[model samples]
Target chain A: MIPATLNVYVGLSALLFAVGLLGVLLRRNTLVIYMCLELMLVASTLAFVAFSRFNGSMDGNVFVFFILTVAAAEVAAGLAIIVALFRKRLTVQVDQLDGLKH
Target chain B: MFPAIFTFLVLFTAVCAAGVIVCRNTVNAAMCLLLCLVGVAGLFVCLEAYLLAFLLLLVYAGAVVTLFLFIVMLIDVRGGAPRARNPLATVAGIIAAALVVGGLASFWVRGHLAAPAASATPALGASLKAYAYPLFTAYLLPVQVLGFLLLVAMIGVVVLSRKPDPGPKP
Candidate 1:
């Protein structure tokens, strides 16, 4: 049973990672890309929870809590940066924002 | 019992994740992400980490993802409607998906996974004691720093989202 649960958990996480990767590659909108990034983070959180359970330690859960904290901070700051960038450029298309490209 | 529940949760998460990627509208994608987070929390439950699972739903799905949706909706920018389908990327996604499924099959076949065992400490308070020692002693500084970082992020968001100065300085 634990084996099956872990398999499902890992499988789900992999699916999530793959979906996020696909979104990153296929989507040009920055906001959608940001959502994809969040999906990827959630996938990692799932993996952490699963492993922590597999080990029978609370450490994984605690680590996931920290990950959540970091994710919150990251999204807040990232969205702010994105907002500022949008203000300056009026567009959120990743391909259009080539100013950073050398 | 656990396997059935876990499989259901995994399927739920997989579908939501697929929705997030395949949806045409940004709002729908954000909603899909919310569903994905909830499914992750459900997986947490199967792992016997009930506290972490609920917290996952509350902190992530309730707060962070909603905030993300708000920002996505507020923004005026738009693009990437996925006009004509690209067969190449679609094929690549399918192959990647299949490989992942194969990895799961291999893991299941190994039969080396361990079940939840009896622990010396079972209660949440005991668990907290175990958690807090390391968190307060070894991880104290990083945790405090993260709090400050969150504070700064909040203030930065408020500042950035504020209206521009109305009058020019003399």
Candidate 2:
């Protein structure tokens, strides 16, 4: 069984990131948008791990760890905000969240 | 065997990631996100980053996705008015995503980036000690800062989500 090359991993990461980007742009639901954001973060983390494995360095792995930590915190805070917004507005649709547009 | 497994994991991750966006139900989208995170963990294992694989499964799949599910259920958000599809935004997004992927693929094809030759040194991500040695040394400051950031996030979530004080009933 041949081992996958670095390019395969990097290309896959790029594809995943692009898919997440498209989701963020196309989705109207706030929660879906948040999930897409996490998807993008995971894509970057995959790239970091792949690079760390290929380069025989700990730096990339360490960065991935930090990214994971930050992502967890971001999700916690972001979800709380989403909940608060839902309570006040009764909807999570981005199109309906135009109170601040004034 | 390894490449085959890697290919399967990559495909699975991509499919699930797309599902997260395409699924209309927020619950289903969150579930897809969970599957995508697991697929990413599998990819980490294939890369020999066992520690990260476990961490990803534990933190992301176990904690984060569950949190999303809880909030989604708690909010009990109803399906609202269908948003009109914005053709202009769709076209722009497609163009931007295509450009980024094409640029990266071109770089890969040009042989501008290559993985370093595998060495005899211990793999950093496979073991906790190996990973911690660097984390506690060169990255100590950043680690400390991350702890502070987590604390702040905790406080912020509590403050933001608490029920407002209500006036006395008439």
Instruction: Estimate, for each residue in B6-109, the C-alpha lDDT of model 2 and write its tens digit.
Output: 77888888899889988989999999999999999998987889989999999999999999999988986665668786788779878877787787678667
Docking class for model 1 is medium
Q: Quick one: best DockQ, which candidate?
A: 2
- Which of the numbered candidates is closest to the native, going by highest lDDT? 2
DockQ of each: 0.51, 0.68
- Which ranges of candidate 2 are over 4 A from the true structure? A1-3, B104-112, B116-122, B167-170
Tens digit of lDDT per residue, candidate 1, span A13-87? 766886887788778788888888888888888877776666666666678778889888888888888888888
Off by over 4 Å in 1: A1-3, B77-129, B162-170
